[model samples]
Target: MSIDLSIDLPGLHLKNPIMPASGCFGFGREYSAFYHLDQLGAIMMKAATGTERFGNPTPRVAETASGMLNAIGLQNPGVDKIIAEEVPFLAKYDTCIIANIAGSTIEEYETVAAAFNQTSDVHALELNISCPNVKEGGIQFGTDPDMAAEVTARVKAASNHPVYVKLSPNVSDIVAMAKAVEKAGADGLTMINTLTGMQIHLPSRKPLLANRTGGLSGAAIKPVAIRMIYEVSQHVSIPIIGMGGICNAEDVLEFLLAGASAVAVGTANFQNPFVCPEIIEALPNVLAQYGFSSVQDAIGKGVSVYE
Candidate 1:
């Protein structure tokens, strides 16, 4: 029995609900060696900036108990390179391409969004307002509702395709942020970017990561991601792409049940290059086990059942 795993996001018709999180999957070229790129739902390319970025210094990544911290600083070759080189490379595949854009200012975000507006290769745009590793932009626009709405509105107005605002978990009221972006006219949402954390090298008496504080991701944050998705889903009407420590079919199911229209696999992609396809392959059986006939049938299943 073929369980229909396809999901219809705001402007994306995903073949399946499994794909790599931005920054985890490096533009989809490297992972092509592991599996066919078209086997998954969509590819969220690395965060693009108005100008090229060298990213953070050495020691940008460190391991923790159940996760890892990263301060990669949204390193990329800029929007021009992404559109000229990477977009065409990904267009070769039969997969949907979602470009993740980061900026230090609203103008930068608008510039990148408007640039993508001229392209037909990109199916959607994910506004990276939740990246904790960056200094100027990223979480700065995400923490406050007004700033988050401003960035969302700007990018939404500039982009022709759908705009999904990636939200930060570092905020005190995540639902408020979600509602703010929704009011700002975000087409969809990707909840719970990495939580802010730090690690110290006890022996050297210095910070483990060069940036001192970095975003934390892995199994440790799955609960937080689910809770935020659940909470935000209760308030917003737009579709959600829930992510944060999703490594297996069960985790994906949890996200769907919590009201995510789709989900992105992040840290797991780093551990196993074949993880996305593996999850996509395993989803049918998992859905059948829960008595669901289609992936969409499971979305928000537990939202009303619980609490």
Candidate 2:
């Protein structure tokens, strides 16, 4: 039996429910060499800010047990450069382009969102309000319900593309955050953006990362991601693009069963640059093994059965 792997989200029509998570996939230049970019679903470009950022200092990344911590600081070549240079390059491919927009303030978020209006190649905007590696703007707006809603509303007004808020797992109530963004006119959600964590160097007796704390990713965070998606999906009506610790096709199916309409491959990209395509290739077989005829059939399957 041929299982259908296509998925339709707010602004994305994916051939398969596997796309590289923002920050991990960069601009798809390097990965394009590995395989044809069109073979996969969408590409979530690295986080873009209103201005070009140099990011954090060295030793910004440290490996932990079954995971890694990063404090990259949303480094990028400003929104203008991305639209002029990077966007067009990726646009050459048949895959959907989702711009991951970040900011240090509400106005900066608005500025970046407005900048994307110049490009028609970008299918959606993944609002980076949940970046834990940064010290300001992102996490502040992400954790507070009112602030999350306000930024979502502002970005919605500023951009023509569909807006999907990336939610912080660091919040006390992930469900509350989801509801706030949905009410603010968010088109969809990208859940469980890295849990805030830190690592220590035994030799120096200090923090491992230069920024002290970083957002953790890799296999370790999959359970937390699944739980958050499951909890939030039950409370909200908007679609979820689940992420965090997704390394294989089984993980993708798990996310779908837990309530995600689609899933993004993050740290796994670092391990295997071709992980996205690999997952996409394996998805149909995995779904059939679980008795699912299509990707949509698996979505919220676990939630409905348990509830």
Candidate 3:
């Protein structure tokens, strides 16, 4: 039986539910050499700020048990360069483009959002208010409900593209953050943006990462991601782009069952550059094996079964 893998979110129509999570996929230049970019669903570009950011110092990444810690500090070439250079390159493909917008202040967020208004290739904006590696802006707005809502509202007012807030797993209540953003007019959500973690170098007797703490991703965070998606989906009406520790097709089906309409592959991309296409190829068979006829059919199934 042929299975349907397409998924329709707020402003994204994905051929399949697999897209590389932002930051991990960069701007898709390197991955283009691995396979055809159009074969995947959407491409969530690396975080873009109002100005070009050099990011944090070296020793910014470290490996852990079943996962890795990263404090890349939202490095990027700023919004202007991205729209002029990156978007054009991605437009060559037939897939959707989602820009990950980040800023150190509300005005910066607004500035970046407004800049995207000049371009039509970008399908949606992933408001990155949840980056834990950074010392300011991201995590501050992400953890506070009122601040999250305010930034969401400001970005919505500034950009024409659909706004999807990336929520931090570091928050005390993930559902509260989801509701605040939704009420503030967010189009959708990208949940569980990596839990804040750290590693120590036994030789130095100090933190492993240069920034002392970093966002953790890989197979280790999958269960936490699934639980957050399941809980938040029950409380909010907006669609969610679930991510964290997604390494295979089975993981994609699990995220859909939990409540995500679509899923983003993050750290897995680092392990296997072709992981997104690989999972997309394996999704249909995996869905059929579990009795799912389509990607949409699996969404929220886990929540409904308990309800």
- Candidate of highest lDDT: 3
lDDT (C-alpha) at residue 175 in model 1? 93
| Clash pairs detected, candidate 1 | none
What is the clash tally of candidate 2?
A: 0
lDDT of 2 by residue, 174-200 (tens): 999999999999999998898899888
Model 1 per-residue lDDT tens digits across residues 1-307: 7799998887788999988999999899999988899897999999999999999997989999989999999889999999999999999999899999999999999999999987898999999998988778888999999999999998888889999999999988999999999999999999879999999998999999999999999999999999999999999999999999999998999999998989999999889889999999889999999989999999999876876
How many clashes does each candidate structure show, in the order listed? 0, 0, 0
Candidate order (lDDT): 3, 2, 1
TM-score of each: 0.99, 0.99, 0.99
The residue pairs found clashing in candidate 3 are none
Residue 107 of candidate 2: its Cα lDDT? 99
lDDT against the true structure, per candidate, is 0.92, 0.93, 0.94
Per-residue error (Å), model 2, residue 189: 0.3
At residue 190, give the lDDT of candidate 2: 96
Model 1 score (lDDT)? 0.92
Rate residue 117 of model 2 by lDDT.
92
lDDT over C-alpha atoms for residue 16 of model 2:
86
RMSD to true structure for each model, in Å: 0.8, 0.8, 0.7
